[model samples]
Target: MSDESEALFDKADTLDEIRDKANKNSNLEMKLRNCIKDSMSKVDSLLTRNDTTQAQLTRHNELVSFMKTYCHERAYSFQIKKCQDVSCNICTPIRLPQTVFDSLHFLPDPVPALDNPDHYTSFQAVYGKQTSEEFRPSLQLNQANAEPAPKSVFASGKIRDYIMCCDCGKWHYVYSDKALSQDEIQDFKQSLYTYDYSCGAPLFPDNHYLAELLFVCVKISCDTPMEILYYSSQKSENSDICYHCGTDSDFIDPPVKMVIGPKRPRFCGPTP
Candidate 1:
């Protein structure tokens, strides 16, 4: 038997021990057990065959790989790692927070509010004035004068703008405009990336579409980065500016066709 097949058999043994003790449903346990048996039989048949071709060996490798993955995923569902699909010019797989993966089924589509100027206006009214000092905790340990990190100015469940870091090409977050709660911010302050007002822990479960607000491609690129006030709920006049490159349609030096971004994904999780 191949090394991979042997490793898979070891995994099967582990699963057998886990299956008996697991609090999982009996039906799922039976399904997993049967799957393991079927996979083992396939492996044994291949190993004992008198004339196993290269093609058969290749297929055996694939089968063993699949079985290993299946056993792990089914046996230890909570430990499954998050995966992402690449969807933009950046050509990098943006690893989403586990929060996003957990909420993919329940998150609503991006409300088309691009036309309502007030949506952007109101957003600015609330969060635009927040300063870095406000995000910091009290430096002095004194009990009486110590102040807490600022509470989020933006209300929960609000979608705002996307933040791109010009200094580091590492930004891919779709700013949901949802500020982390005071407690969350406090917790985040201790993390390595918490030097500024960045999220320390993985962004707790939020809508993935909130991350999709800024993944558009615009025809024109502008020198000044203007905030595009888009009210995603509006059906007409969705394009006041480029969500991708921050180009104002009105200020196009030479009038060009308005930026019509390709259909953005409505939900999060996988790109498709």
Candidate 2:
């Protein structure tokens, strides 16, 4: 009823109004949060459905096994033709001409004659004509000097076989009759386990034949079937064409031959 009492009642009314407004704002904020959460859940469900359809499409577009095999065969053939350098470990061993051996400053001491004539004949046959020709003079000289020949040099009678490695592109000379050394066997096994699919150019220079040969050796040694599988998905772009020869499933069209005719003179402007 008094002026101070009325002022206190008005202040209490203002505080109640403020509290009601604050409660309303809190309710609105909670509704907004729930709305955002529901919307996110719907978006995630849609994305998952879309991903499943896309995965199916991708599987449908993938290359089949036969196509993959065809591409690999073409690529392998092209690589072999391109990598015919003499330095290749898979290439046939080059026998230096007699002149080269003669020119060397430090040639192996001339092979002495064998006590058995049959052994000497067999050795000569194994060496081939050029080798026999190269050493014939030295052998005659040694015979004249009456030097006794050692039989141990050709006692084994086993020719050394060259083992070509695909991974390192190196040749290892080993006797055919003897088993591979522990280190050599371990090295082969290591290579088998750690074979690289991307080996090409520079050191290898497009040599895949040796790698195939090495894989064949692996199959024989382990008594397991091994194969190189090429997948189109591995490429940055999905393509069925051969990387080396630019060939595809379509047959190559023959080049068009153009016949050139004489050029006509330019016409002058009419009547200047």
Which numbered prediction scores highest in lDDT against the true structure? 1
Give the TM-score of each candidate.
0.17, 0.12
Worst 10 residues of 2 by lDDT: 224-233
Residues 174-216, model 1: lDDT tens digits: 2334455665444433432432222222232234322222121
Candidate 1 residues lying further than 4 Å off, grouped into runs, are: 1-162, 168-180, 185-272
Question: Cα lDDT for residue 164, model 1?
Answer: 33
The root-mean-square deviation over C-alpha atoms between each candidate and the true structure, in angstroms, is 25.5, 39.4
Q: Report the lDDT tens digits of candidate 2 across residue range 71-148.
A: 223211321111235554323443666566344331122344567643344543344233323345555665654412
- Top TM-score model: 1
Clash list (residue pairs), candidate 2:
none
Candidates' C-alpha lDDT: 0.35, 0.33
Alpha-carbon shift of residue 109 in model 1 (angstroms): 33
